[model samples]
Target chain A: MFLQQIINGLTVGGVYALIALGYTMVYGILELINFAHGEIYMIGAYLGIIFLGIFTTAGLTQYSLPLSLFLTVVLSVLFCSAYGFTVEKLAYKPLRNAPRLNPLISAIGVSIFLQNYVMLTQGATDKVFPHVLPVTTIEFSGITMTSLQIIIIVVSLLLMAGLHLFIMKTRTGKAMRAVAQDKVMASLLGIDIDRIISVTFIIGSGLAAVAGLMVAMYYGLVNYSIGYIAGIKAFTAAVLGGIGSVPGAMIGGFVLGLIESLGAGYLSSEYKDAYAFIVLILILMVKPTGLLGKSEGHKP
Target chain B: MLKLENIHTSYGHIEAVRGTNLEIRKGEIVSLIGSNGAGKSTTLMTISGILRPVKGKVIFEGREIQGLSPHKIVSMGVSQVPEGRRIFPKLTVRENLEMGAYLKGKGQRAKGKGSGVKGQEARGKGEDTSRGDSRIALAEQLDHIFNLFPVLKERQKQLGGTLSGGEQQMLAIGRALMSGPELLLLDEPSLGLAPIIVIKIFKTIRELNAGGLTILLVEQNAKAALRLAHRGYVIESGRVTREGIGKELLDDPAIKRAYLGE
Candidate 1:
C-alpha cells in the first residue's frame, strides 16, 4: 500500500516538476514570478487535445498510435513555445526596466487574459481526453503500477537530464547564467541580453507544455480553469525547492507530491491540495531561501 | 579612432556628464582624470554605449554610434572594464573568461546575422581568435592571459567571489582582453587597490598599449593615470577643464594642487 502511494505520488510529482522548471528558469533570470506561466501550461493541454482531435478526425490515430502521439507532442510543444516567446516580448519586454511591481502586475494581467481567452474559445466545460493510453497494470508482489505512471516518470527524467546538460555544457547556457548574475557586465561582453531572455522563455514554456499534455492524458480531462490551481501548486513546489534552483524544483515537486498523496491516504482526503502548502510553509519557516537557494546578498 | 561630442548624460534628473568632448587615436592610452562623480566614468560609459547621451554624437571609426546598444558597441571592437569588478561570482574563473570571449564566438559562423541589423554589424577589424578552431584556439588565448597573470591559472577552478579584490580586478581586465577588442575602456581600474597592485596593473596597461592596443582610461588616481597615458583630459563638473599631453598635465601647477596632491 505504501508503494502504491509512492507510484501515484511520483506520477503527479513528475508533472509538477515540468511546470516548476518553467517558474524556476524564468525566475532565475528575470527574478519575476511568472504568474502567466500556468496559463501557458493550460494552453498546452488544450493544444494537445486539439491536435489529438485533428489526428482522430483525419483517421491517423486509427492506423498508428505512435505517429499520432509524435505529431501531437511536436505541434503542441511548438505552439506553446510561440505563446511563451510572445508573452515575454509583448508583456515583459516593455516593462523590463520599470519598477518591479509593474512586471508582477503585468504577469498577473497576462494570466487573466490567457484564462479568459481559453474559456471564451473552448467553452467553460471540461474537455475529454481520449483514454488511448492503456490502463494495463504491472503487478510486482502487492504493488501494481500503471503504464502511464512509468511513461511520465521516464519522460520527465529525460527532459530534466537534457536541461541539466544544456545549462552546464553549452556556450549559450553559460551566457544565460552570466546574464542572470550581472546583466550590465554580460552586455558589455557582447552577449545579446534580449535574445537570451527570449530563448529562456521558449525552453521553459516547451517543458511546461509537455507536462500539461501528460497530465491531461493521465487524468483523462482538462479544463481552462485547471491552470489556476495547478499553477499555485507548482509555484508552491518551486518555492519549496528554492525558487531559482532547477534540481531543487524537481526534488520539491516529488516531496510535495508524496506529502499530499500520503496525507490524503492516511490523514484527511479532503485537504489533499492543502497538504502541499502546509508543508511548504513549515519548510520555509525553517529555511527562508528554501532547500538549495543561496542568499543573493549581492543583488542590487 | 573614437570621438565624443557634446555628450550629456544623466542618472534620473541629475546630470553626470554634460557637453563632454574627447578624442583618442590608435595605439594611444588616453586618460580621463577627475575626482569622484566628475563624469570620468560617465564618459567611458557613453563611449561603450552603456549610457545613451541625450544630446551629441559618438563617432567610432568615422561612423555615428551614439544610440547603439552596449553589446553592439562591444561587437564593433569597443569594450569596457566596468568601475566595479562585476564578475559573475557564482561562475568559476574559467567560465568568467569564457564569457569574455562571447563576441568572438558569435562572429564565427554568423557573419550574415549582423547584416540586416543596420549599422551595428561586426565592423571591428579586431581578431576573433576564439572562434571554432576547436579548443586549441581558445586554449592559446587563455594561456596568453594566464602568462600575464599567472595566479589566475592556479585558481582557474575557484569561484570569482572567492578571489581577492586585486585578483578580481585582474580577472575583469583579462576577460575584456579575451574579446580581442581594438579600443579598450578601463573605468577606475585602480580604485581601492594596494599601491603595489596598482603599479602592476599600470605596468600591464602599458604593456598592452606597447603591443598596439588603443585605450581610453578613466581614473581617480590622477598621478598614476597621467604618468601612464600619452594624453590626458581633466573633466571638472562634466566638462573638460584641461586637455594636453600626459606629461604637460602632470606638470601643471593647478592640476598638481587639485588632483596630483603634490
Candidate 2:
C-alpha cells in the first residue's frame, strides 16, 4: 500500500513540478507573483479539449490517435503561450516602473479576469476529456502502476531536462540571468530587457500548458475552476522549495505530493489539501528563505 | 566625437543637469569634475540614454541620439561604467564579461553589424566574422581584457561579489570593454579605493586613451582627473562653471580653492 501511494505521489508530483516551474521562473525574472498564471494553465486544458473535439469532428482521431494528440498538444501550447505573452504585454509591461504593489494588484486583477473569461466562455459545467490514452496496469506484488502514470513521469522529466539544458548552455539564458541580477547594468551591456521578459513569459506558459494537458489526461475531466486549486498547490510547492529557484520548485513539487499522498493514505483523507500548508509553515519557521533560496541584498 | 547641448534633466520636480553643454573631440580624455549632486553622474546617465533629457540634444558621431534606448546607445559604440560598479554578484567574473559582450554574440552572426567603432581591428570591429571565427574573436577579446588587467584573468572563475572593491571596479570596466566601445563613459572610478589602487586605475585609463579610445571620465578626485585629462570642465549647480586646458585649470586659483582643496 505504501509503494502504491509512492507511485501515485510521483504521478501527481510530476504535474506539480511542471506547473511550479512557471511560477518560479516568472518570479525569478520579474520578482512578481504572476497570479494569472493559474488561469493560463486552466485555459491550456480547455484548449486541449476544444482542439481534441475539433479533431474528432474532422474524423482525424479515427485515423491516427498519435497524430491527433500531437496536433492537440501543439495547438494548446501555442495558444497558451500567446495568452501568456499578451498578459505580460498588456498588464505587466506598463507597470514595470510602477510601485511593486501596483503590479501585484494588477496580477490579481488579471487572474480574476481570466478566470471569469474562461468560465463564461466554456460554461461553468465540468468538461470531460476524451479518453484516448491506452489503459494498461502492471502489477508487482500488491502494488499496481498504470501506463498513464509512467507516461506522465517520463514526459515531465524530459521537459525539465530540456529546460535545464536551455538555461545552462544558451546565450539567451545567460542574458536572462544578467537581467534578473541587475536591469540597468544589463541594458548598459546591450541586452534588451523587454524581449527577455517576454521570452520568460512565453516559456513559463508553454510549460504550464503541458502540465494542464497531462492533468486533463490523468483525471479524464477538467473544469474552469480546476486551475484555482492546482495553481495554489503548485505555488505552495514553489515557495516551499525556493520561490525563485528552478531546481527547488521541482524538488518541492515531489516532496509536497508525497506529503499529501501519505497524509491522505494514513492520517485523514479529509485534510489532504491542508498538508502542503502545514509543511510550508513549519519550513518557513526554520528557513525564511525557503529550502534552496539564498538571501539577496537590495541593489543601491 | 560626442557633444551635449543644453541638456536639462530632472528627477521628479528637481532638475539635476540644467542647461549643461559639453563636447569631447575624437581621441581626447575629457573629465567632468564636480561636487556631490552637481550633475556629473546625471550628465553621464543622460548621454548613455539611461535618462531622457527634457531639453537639448546628445549627438554621437555626428548623429542625434538623445531619445534612443540604453541598449541601442550601447550598440552604437557608447557604453557606460555606471556609478557604484554594478557587477552582477551572482554571475562569475567571466559570465559578467560575457554579458558585456551580449550584442556581439548570436545576433552578430545574423546581423553582421558590430558597434560604431572605426580604425581599430582588434578593439571594436566585429563584422565579417563567421561562427567559428566569432568564437575565436570572443576568446581573443577576453585575452585582450586579461592582458589589460591580469588580475581579472586570475579571478575569471570567481563570482563577481567575491572580488574586492578594486577588483570589482576592474571587472566593471572590463565588462564594458567587451562590447568594444569607441566611446567609454566612466563614473567615479576612484571612489572608495586605496590610493595605490586609484593610481593603478588612472594609469590604466591613460593607457587606454593612448590606444585611441575616447574617454569621458567623471570623478570627484578633481586633481587626478584634471591632471590626466587633456581638457577639463568644472560643473557647479548643473552648469559648466569653468572650462580650460588640464594644466591651466590645475593652475587656476579659484579652481584650486573650490575643488583642489588648496
**Would you list the C-alpha lDDT of every candidate in the order shown?**
0.87, 0.88
* Top candidate by DockQ: 2
Residue-level lDDT tens digits of model 1 in B140-172 = 568778877899999999999899999999999
| Candidate 2 residue runs with Cα over 4 Å from true position | B108-133
For residue A90, model 1's alpha carbon misses the true position, in angstroms, by 1.0
Question: All models, DockQ values?
Answer: 0.78, 0.83
* TM-score for candidate 1: 0.95
- C-alpha lDDT (0 to 100) for residue A203 of candidate 1: 95
Off by over 4 Å in 1: B108-136
Question: Which of the CAPRI classes, incorrect, acceptable, medium or high, describes model 1?
Answer: medium
